[model samples]
Target chain A: MPEDFEVNPWDVKGKVDYDKLIERFGTQRITRDLKERFESVVGELHPMLRREVFFSHRDLDLILNDYVSGKGFFLYTGRGPSKEMHIGHLIPFIFTKWLQDKFRVNLYIEVTDDEKFMQKNELDLEETRKWAYSNIQDIAAVGFDPDRTFIFTDIEYVRNMYPLAVRVAKKLTFSEVRATFGFTESTNVGMLFYPSLQIVPTMFERRRCLIPAGIDQDPYWRLQRDIAESLGFYKVAAIHSKFMPPLTGTEGKMSASQPETAIYLTDDPKTVRLKVNRYAFSGGQPTVELHRKLGGNPEIDVPFQWLYYFFEPNDQVITAIERDYRSGKLLTGELKEILIEKINEFLERHRERKEASKDMIEVYMRRGKLATVMWETVHGLSV
Target chain B: MPEDFEVNPWDVKGKVDYDKLIERFGTQRITRDLKERFESVVGELHPMLRREVFFSHRDLDLILNDYVSGKGFFLYTGRGPSKEMHIGHLIPFIFTKWLQDKFRVNLYIEVTDDEKFMQKNELDLEETRKWAYSNIQDIAAVGFDPDRTFIFTDIEYVRNMYPLAVRVAKKLTFSEVRATFGFTESTNVGMLFYPSLQIVPTMFERRRCLIPAGIDQDPYWRLQRDIAESLGFYKVAAIHSKFMPPLTGTEGKMSASQPETAIYLTDDPKTVRLKVNRYAFSGGQPTVELHRKLGGNPEIDVPFQWLYYFFEPNDQVITAIERDYRSGKLLTGELKEILIEKINEFLERHRERKEASKDMIEVYMRRGKLATVMWETVHGLSV
Candidate 1:
């Protein structure tokens, strides 16, 4: 049996990988340029499309078909503030921003502060709310237009949206929530109703909202979309992304808990280089001659995978590096230098775009909530 | 055992010596001369007392003690509104009106629409609301001042006057409500919360209201008072009247379903006369010889007991009839004739009051509500 089979699910860094997953599920990768098709399906594409990490979607084509027939749909994604935000938190926002900018779709972002509180007790409600604000700022930094996007903090919205929320809560039973969440008999009422909070935003209107999430949460979104139809809600489309893996290992994605596991946007070139050299998981032959025979397993190497995720300008460089490393031309240290260079250049661009970062982000969030709040108020919920 | 030992509790027509009731319950039968003393305890004896139907009371001395010491309490009673108002509904108002006039105390008349709806499903909510207004008019016709009285409909007041109802609902489990109300799993949620609704209005504001009901409902009130302490509500005071058996053979207190069981204030003189002659239970034997031999069994005879409840005009006349009946001189027909005459006069007076009724009653109801709405609005729940 492969040593890889011994990894426990929870002990993995933050999330699991896609290719390994694709192999596990026996699914093919979506390769080739689909932007023109997506534009016809959705409307437009954001600039981030130079790399297609948001590579899979359900119902996008159908909604695009509907839109071409002069129909329109809104956009929705959830940010569960259970932990501090990392750059990975931006993945859904990144796509959602693109969807919003290109299609002019109304956007709804749910800040699930209450869900975070029930999930972990050490975080008080107020601090968790701060986490929500921090996370929204991060999402806003990804460039969702303020006028079209809405950000809802669940606590404030729930008080004003009691009638609609109660309607949803009543239709869902205690046992159903328990079965769905794997909750025990001791689970509190708040926990029992938390999933209904997510369901609420989707049922906001008889229209369109796409949920972009990691594949693991596909099970939950699938349940939500099914329940929505039964409760007379517009079906929610799900856009699934590959898990962004941690620097410490390719066993899984980076998590906020371990600073070394994540190559944070704030990391300097020295830190990024040290982090990759010291902690990035890799496999090589015991000697250079033997390494030449083994070749680099790009699939298992975290740095190579990150280089693929972020190193947009030089696919040819990575491809040549892949060739050289596999045939034992370039060594591990040489591969690390190229990855460090790629990340530094990426951060430098991010820094350049970080002009008026805090102020601009704050303004966007405030303006975004106005549109969101206004729409929510009409859809039987208050912001 | 004496013949009285076999008294049929349901029979009301012949006679009942309430002197026996006062003796059995250890309550004092207050005379008209103790007008000042009666005024002190249950509050001022109403002009309805100038007529005498509300002839006796419990803890009169104690209540009088409290009132005389400058300590004040309020008047409280409520209607179930299970059916239309009858002349019978005027008992509380007549007594309450007297108390209001004498002691100058505050009055709270609760119209229990929530309890009625919870108990009976066939009853229309809107219809019960109409019935509440009609019942309130009848209560006002008894002549209460606008400033001194508060009448709240439970459906509205349960939502407005007390957060205590919510607190109580939280404390109760389904099983607890089931045991208390004999409810099953099929019982609806609103029905399950009925007891809490009743208890809240009883102690609406620091025992600001005192309940006036028949003795049989003592169990419900006692239970409410028990639960109130746990909910942090002030202990409510309850004044229970002896049950007045229905006219169905005069064996029990009047029930709405049985046509012959009650005296409707709307009853024409002919209907009153026929009901008195045919249905008021008789204690006289089947034969005049037997009646003369045994004398009228005052215990089981319904009309004489009713006289104790209603025929308050001249005790000398009442005492004279009692003596003549026990002495076997007063025929059962003669006794029923006297009751029919007395009831006709009483009904006439109420009818006249009903005739003079005007829109001014709403003014009193509104004034009563305004006096208390500000205080009850503390939880920000009032309309």
Candidate 2:
């Protein structure tokens, strides 16, 4: 029987089967040959690609071909500034930074402050704007090339995007977005019109735009592909990644409301250690003696899953840990300790970079080479 | 019996009854006392006001109270640049100019190029933008105070207005606009969101905003009144005018697609004379002998209506014309000649002013006192 799961841009639930999602969403799997092709061009694959964390794609091969042929491609991704940043929130940005570094191409990061305010009834514009500033700092900590990356918030940069957005909006009817986004008659007009703003950055460059985002966001890309070519731009290309499971279990993605189920980027070292020791779902036997005899199931473990998905990148190290856990050599406490240390180290480096990059955020948002050009130019139909 | 008429922002049909429209639209009649109050302050009433062409209002007394009590109000109006403008299109601007000259307050004219493009399937942004330029020239020819007036197109000035627009949009829902603007599910999202942009200028200043427009536009101001106080601004005030009847008949307002039913601002003397002589709906007997025997009905005559509405501003001249036409002293051909001369002379002066005020258009759009300040400010929630 099929696994019980649901996923969309707004909500995700239950245990998702990644391969089944590829079939259900009508996307192609990241086959071994395609991985080899990526490695051939970049000289090596990032850990996310090596481990198949990003396992689904649409028109990605075409993007690779354009890059190889010197036709070029660019990257676009975004954040909805509705709350504080968590570790799961940074996963796609970390992978996107790697893609930008290897390809030496431009990247545009849209912080959708306007959508966040319009989508949530309790959140106001000032609150979303505050979160937008803090989230931009976390994204900046991912170490993207400031000269090549341009970060913008929807409310601040809308003037440059609205002309093109209206053109895209005209091609779509309320019926189309209502079906694609599951919008209802009660949805505010601002929220209903927001998809066009989200689609504008993909057409910022003439070349193909490759988006590195969670699989749930594929619907927007599907809508963009339907209209981009008609507006004198290429259909957007996208690579989709599975969500990082919550710390307490592997059934679904992290929840921002449940503070215990996820680690925040601002969580201190002590909080990280305590949360891991107290809450990380273990697959070991009940007692110490029983775990030594029966061994642990690393396949169902949250700590091991988090490490394999992001924290631990070394192939040999992860392999050894898996082997030891399955053979009754590693205890549950010991495994939890490993994840705790890895998370604290990552958070420490992220915090330090965020503290030192106060001026760098300005570079990425306004004064950088790519950002300067974007601010001076208004994106619209070329014809 | 009630008149068989329809009125909305997008469509106007039948012969509108001014007295019934006031009751139907839930607006107050511009009473004789209000005209006397205007004369008390401004020394004399404008011909449009004196003759009751602008016959209805909402909160005109409050606007006057604020003006006399040392607090002040401003004027707001707009145009949809879907096609070339005609004499009917310039009615509100002409009255607004009179208000600005008398009140010496700021004026904001929104040229909605984006709305026109979204509302009409066949019109493109480039085409609407072309009309916006030509239409703004006609508005400038009405001779507004360039230092105090600011004219902006939606596409070009959206950056400054969008923040406030989203604030206003958040207070509205799809259901609300659908009911107010007659929007359906098939309406494009851009068109659904356009009422917010139109409402933004009403909140540009802290004092009340007085709008001089056709009664069909009352729905937009009504929506604005519902949400303005919640956004920390006063509810807008308005003065409503009647539509100038088409040349062919007095059944409906002039249409852009039916060129012979209206006189274009660019129409030369020959075209004006030909259209009026050929198509002007006469309220006379079928022949000259019968017309001399039975008096003409000036009430139903399109030429006499045009003179009463705008052309013959002199009280004595209009009264003499009305008396002579009612007594059969002015024949149909003679009355058409009088209207043709008035329109051609008006067109000649308009064309001359449009040609000479190229620099004045710049001042109203960008450089002069109010335009410069507006360009530097972004309107949003005051708190």
Candidate 3:
């Protein structure tokens, strides 16, 4: 059977196509405060100041415009469950987590089970639940505090909060939902209402919401901000990131569903070594001589981008690899060998904390929900 | 204040205008089973197989249609937080509580503290909680099983069940809601979503929703039914009562907002007697000769309507009252005396048992919520 078309910002490779994402999101003016917030999150100056992998923004100017007024908001970003969770997946989560810790405001890392369930034809809740749990671990591994963060399943809260869900449902329409989600006539009502569910924590009457995600999801955030005002609430803010290509295959980006295309969080050392060596989507030829004359194209080389995101806090190693590749002295296999060792060590630490991280995930989810829940309780329909 | 064109059904005079209600509901056939359900609940078998005050429906047909198709569904109904329910409020509650007992299906009754807060424009949450508890006792007086019934307050469940509410909101629009609730744009968003909140229980996959209200609320049910099909949901069934005119006052129905217009469930014999003798929308004449010739119009007498609702379970007393009233053999004072004695006895029994009944309400609320929570855990999103 043919696989149905399944492309959402949270899933699509083009989810981070910055220009198109901004057009789609209808966002504007990346502000100085957002940049400052970005700097505060990263803690140090970037190697590529002119090149922005973290792209697009909304209501960012408002924060800057109000900076002298001494008011600020919080941050939000999330995952669509645990599919592969490669380095591509970590860019936004890690950065957003950093922003949250630095800013000292509420953070909400939503796990979009309801989005996945509605987008997928099958109602395999267990798979969704599994994906949620695994993705939560990845989020926790990114290091958000249990006290300041929140994660929740749609079904869990839908059961717990009938009145609130109903209030949100009334503010939206099929036309608006379809516009936001790219829903077709065949789209389920669940999907139609799904965006509002994501946006709800933002309006919370009290907790000002700031979203962090790849540029692709900016459309959803923009829709939420508009609807919030209609519901008589505060406009939400967001930080958007650029796309990171998968290391292999022609599927456009890294994906666990396509094994050769991406490296898993649990990738064994040998597997990582083999995958990088064999299918890193090289810019160089099979023979070294042909490649020396032609030179390497940095744009399409997945290994270079991978190094940028993962070979962090160390320029000596990253520069050496870049110098070797520029001079045609470092063979693709040699680079793979280096990444294999680097990635393996990273996964080793991840696994060490993976079991201990269950409590961490629980804490993020519980705390995140508590912040929103507490605010919602006090301000609810009255606000 | 002119009260912005008052239409509170709690203010209906001697014969409710069913045709006007049906015209407003805009349905051709409300279905026979809905009427039968109401009759079964009200304990009055209409000889004409007639539809009375409850002239509109939403999912009443869906329910009838479901029953016709041999599928079982539960009934849903609830009340607002009346501090101490008067004789007027029990017309719907007693009937709905009976349906819960006979049908052996799930029942959910919501106490709308959220609605009261908006209506009274007050913020005393403790008083709302107090009213929730107080109203529960009056609800328990009708005797529903604690195991089968669930009672919820807007404050308690809104946060947990907002997803269900989101569905309701999606199916309805602001203009549509305004039309149902009779408000302008300045009305609180909480009131805008009030009908949707009332509706969340109907979509309760575990509990079938059947609303018990007055004909004044018919517009809300009519809109709910149309939207249910649009959203692929079962409609809420309804049992609407003709209004219960007040014990005192010169005109119209009982109203809690006006102290003289209602008989509180806690009123003692002295209060009942005094109020009845002095106030009850009299049909008596100023002169003895004129009264003898004109007699009394029981149809226009508010006390007779109250007696019919509260005092006469059998036809004999009603017929005798009617005959004496038309013949002028019964003075207005005599009729008032009968009503006062009947209502005093009724209120006394309720007051005596209220403390115990209040305890039962708490148990019912906890058990019902537990059942609903479990159902959603295993079965997934119901209204």
What DockQ does every candidate get?
Answer: 0.05, 0.58, 0.09
Ranking by TM-score: 2, 3, 1
CA error at residue B9 for candidate 1, angstroms: 33
Q: Model 1 in CAPRI terms: which quality?
A: incorrect
Question: What is candidate 3's CA lDDT for residue B239?
Answer: 56
TM-score of chain B of 1: 0.79
Residue A131's C-alpha lDDT in candidate 1? 82
Among these predictions, the greatest DockQ belongs to: 2
Better of 2 and 3 by TM-score: 2
Candidate 1 lDDT by residue in tens digits, B162-232: 33444444444445544444554444334544555556565555533455655434444545655667655
iRMS for model 3?
Answer: 8.1
Task: Provide the lowest-lDDT 10-residue window in model 3 chain A.
Answer: A374-383
For candidate 2, the TM-score of chain A alone relative to the native chain A: 0.97
Instruction: Tell me, per candidate, how large a share of the native contacts it keeps.
Output: 0.00, 0.63, 0.05
Off by over 4 Å in 2: A1-4, A381-383, B1-3, B381-383
What range of 10 consecutive residues in model 2 chain A has the weakest lDDT sum?
A374-383
Task: Report the Cα lDDT for residue B283, model 3.
Answer: 76
Question: Taking the tens digit of each residue's C-alpha lDDT, what string does model 3 give over A1-383?
Answer: 54322335746643234554466457664545556764654475353321356556676555444433556676667777636477677767666765666566667656777667556644355667777777777767777666666666665654433344444554555556556666554443445546656766676535456776666676667666766765566788765666667777323557767788888887888888888888888765567786666656545567766776554436786777777776777766666666677778878887777766776665555545554464345333332
Residue A272, candidate 2: how far off, in angstroms?
Answer: 0.7
